[model samples]
Target: MAFRDLAMAMVYFSQTLIGTVGNVLLLYHCSCLHFTKSKLRPTDLILKHLLVANSLVILFRGVPETMAAFGLKDFLSDLGCKLVLYVHRVGRGVSIGSTCLLSVFQVITISPRNSRWTDLKLTAPEYVSIISILCWILHMLLNTIVLMYVTDRRCHKNITYRKEFEYCSTIRQQKSRTILHAALLFLPDALCVGLMLWTSSSMISILYRHKLRMQHVRKTNFTQRSSPETKATKTIILLVSTFVCFYSLSSIFQALFTLYNNPDRFLVNVAAVVTGGYPTVSPFLLIKHFPCISNLTDCVRNKKTYNVKRIMQLS
Candidate 1:
């Protein structure tokens, strides 16, 4: 393999490994909490969904791309190609949807009680699980259209097909039909991204106001230390910002690839890397702020204390 290919493969391999491990660890922690009957916040439930979606995105996208980068060929069957691409599309949609939902939830959470959103703030937690389930269903149904287009690269060598990935080829369609399909796929993602932008702006506004109020009341400089709400809001804002940046770059690369008559391997590789950026990075952001670490530490401390008490009693 060329140096460029080797480098790209290494990048994908690193992203896949780190992202998968981080998501799984956090997911396992969340599951343990659920099974142990620990109280979970509404945000926690949304986060669990996000983690699962991120894991799917990383695994399906990263693994295949890495293999392809390493000069693998015709490894997937037609069914395998369809399944991999379909799941990747669904996972990407769900990841976007989940992030949008999380932002909306945070905005509702931090809204002033006297505001018009009070009722939603009161009731949103009850519906988080339902909303997350609906997101998954919506994406699953929407991406079924992908199955009709995607096939293994080797399956259609004699026919004219657009090479979407190293292992996946998509049947070319009429211009109008292709446009329609593009619109159908783009609309939902656009809606979710728009929602995220709006919610993130609102959160920034709310945080600013809260900061001002705190500074006024305390008559001192607001330090790095902040309330849990402020910290959570900041984290979501950062998350949304990161998603928007990476998503926009990936979209631009994809558009260029589509418009060009013959896109280079570098363009395709860059797009794949940009596409996987959010999934690979977001998990670490979440893991840093996740309460699971503290919970685990507390459990260990309690266990040690109990053992010491037993030893004392025996002596």
Candidate 2:
């Protein structure tokens, strides 16, 4: 493989492995075991669903793209292309919705009793499920048109307008894509950003109150910052940060591809880099926020160091 391909493969493999492992552990912890005294809380359920969605995204996006990066021929046939792309898009939509719901839920859950958000926690979980179902249905219907338009081009052939292939959409359908793009891409993204901003602002206000309380108390407990509420805040911050980084990078590359009529080589490479960001960072984020995970990490690190010292002493 060329140096570029080798580098891309490393990135793709690492991200896929790390993201898969981290999300899988998170899923197992929340789903198969009781990590908290609270039984099957709304946030726990949301995390489980999010991990499933993320795992699907990694599979559909990471595998084929990695093959293509290594200069392989079209592994994804026409149906594969349509289905994989469909699942990736739908999974991403669900993830965005779930993250938004997580943020909103956290804000409400952590809000003071007098705050407006407390009223939302009572009903948010039920509505979040309804919204998830509606979102899946809507995204599936919107992407069905993709199968009608996309077909398998021959090996090593780039996509180009061909007269013989009636599979390429008519002018009317092309116009429809414009409308669908606005509906699917712009609307959902805007809503996510709005929700994130609201949640972040609320978190800031909470932090301000925390600081003020810390200042007034001369001998306050240092452990207050390490409480469950604080840990949850940190976890949400990590989630938001990862979401923004990955999605923003992908969106930028996609826009450049469309606007500049760039070569697929450049666009694909950018996409590969952007896509791996989530899986690569997710494990570290989980490790950082969870005390149990921190303890486990420390134990592993100390064990390795001790083994190394013993070997040196024997030498």
Candidate 3:
């Protein structure tokens, strides 16, 4: 294998490994919260959906990209290509939708008790399940278009196409059809991203106002630990910011690949990396906020301290 191919393989393998582990761990944590009859927050419910979507995105997209990086050819059959691409698109849509839901829900959760959104705040949790289900169903239906165009690379080896997905090749369509299909695919994602941006801005405004009020009341230079709402808002902001940044980079690379007659191999690899970046990094961002992880660490620390004290007394 060429050194570039080997290096790309290693990078993708690492990304897949880390993302899989993080998602699985966090999923297990969420499962524990559910099964243990713990008081599950609305955010927790949304997070469970996000983690599952992230896992799918990482596995379906990352594994194939990794294999392709290793210079694997004809590794997937025609059916395999369709299934992989379809699932990856659905997973990615769900991931974006779930993030948007999380942000909007947080904004509702933190709104003032007398605000116009009070009714929404009270009822948002109840609709999370329904909304999530609709998101899944919508994406699943929307991405069926993939099954029509995608085929095993071997089947299309002789045909020229503007886009290539390494293991899969798309059957080029008429310009009008391509534009219509592109619009169908882009609209839903654009809507979700727009909502996320609006909600994020609202959150920042709310946080700023709260901070100013606190400063006026305290009249002190020392910083106080933020309230739970503040902390949660900050986490969601960070998560959304990370997603937008990575998604933008991935979209740019994808656009270049589509427009260029013969895109460079390096562009494809970088796009894959950027595409998977949000999934690989999001779990770690959330893990820090999981109470169970913190509790687990504290238990281990106390156990170690107890063991050391016992040894010292015996000595």
Candidate 4:
């Protein structure tokens, strides 16, 4: 391989490894909680689902690109290509749906007692399993077109039949089919985006009102008092924003690849990287925002602070 290709391969290898390990840790943490805890919190419910979705995304999306980066593009058979690409697409769709659910659930969970959604907080926990299963089935059905369209592009001497794949060919679609499926997929994506925006906005507004009320009641300088719910909201917001940013970036790059006859290999890699980037980074962000984790960090900081004091006393 050329120096550039080798470097790209290394980049992908490192990212995939990091992403895999991070997601595995997340999965392990959630699994332990699920099995050991008496009851799963709603937040944990969403998080566990998100972790599974992210792991699949990282595995399916990152592995192929990493292999391709190292110059092993033609290794997949037609059936293998179909299965890999189909699973990857389904994983991405599930991740999107899971994020939307998490965001909306947090908003509802934190809603004011008198608010319209207040009643949902009690009932939402019951529906989590059903909603998640529906999300899986819905996305699975929506993306089955991949099975029909994704074929091995490696040995195709006829370039016309080739579809776009992550490391290889993707689903070959004509203008009509492309437009139709895009519309179908966009309906859910658009719904998710809309729901996330509204829920996030509502939570922000609630926070603002809450702060003002606290200030009024105290009649003193406002200090930040964050609840566990607030922390979860922040985590959900960060995950949503990160997912949306990467999702858009990857889509734009993919679009550009289709538009241009000769697209840069670096751009392709960047797009592929963005595809797996959020799944890589989101677990760390989630861990960072957890109340227990933050408290543990604070304890460590305090221990260090005390150690410094002891050293000074000894001196």
Best prediction by lDDT: 3
Instruction: State the lDDT of candidate 4 residue by residue for 1-315, as single tens digits.
Output: 899878878878888889878777666655544443435677677777777888888888778887887788788888888788788888888888899999988889888999999789789989998899899999999998777666776655565645454355664567898779778877898799889888888888887887777876654434556777777787888888888888788878868976765577778878878888988898888877554443445444555666687789999
Ranking by TM-score: 1, 3, 4, 2
> What C-alpha lDDT values do all the predictions have?
0.85, 0.66, 0.86, 0.78
C-alpha TM-scores of all predictions: 0.90, 0.80, 0.90, 0.86
* Model 3 lowest lDDT segment of ten: 294-303
lDDT of 1 by residue, 192-291 (tens): 9999999999999888887777776754446556878888888999999999999999889978877874578788888888888998888777765767
Q: What is the per-residue lDDT of model 2 for residues 216-304, given as tens digits with 9 covering 90 to 100? A: 77764762446677788768877787788788888787666455433456566667667656655655676654444545555445556
lDDT of 2: 0.66
lDDT agreement of model 4 with the native: 0.78
What lDDT does candidate 4 reach at residue 72? Answer: 82
Instruction: Name every residue pair that clashes in candidate 4.
Output: 163-170, 164-169, 164-170, 165-169, 165-170
Residue range with the least summed lDDT across 10 consecutive positions in model 4: 291-300
Better of 1 and 3 by lDDT: 3
Q: In order, how many clashes per candidate? A: 0, 0, 0, 5
Q: How much does candidate 4 score in TM-score?
A: 0.86
TM-score of 1: 0.90
- Is candidate 2 or 3 superior in lDDT? 3
lDDT of 3 by residue, 1-315 (tens): 999899999999999999999998888777666554567888888998899999999999899998888888779999999999899899999999999999999999888888888999778889999999999999999999989888886784566664566777778778799889889999998898899999999999988888777876754543577777788899999999999999899879878866875678788889889989999999999887886765665544555666687789999
On the 0 to 100 scale, the lDDT of residue 214 in model 1 is 76
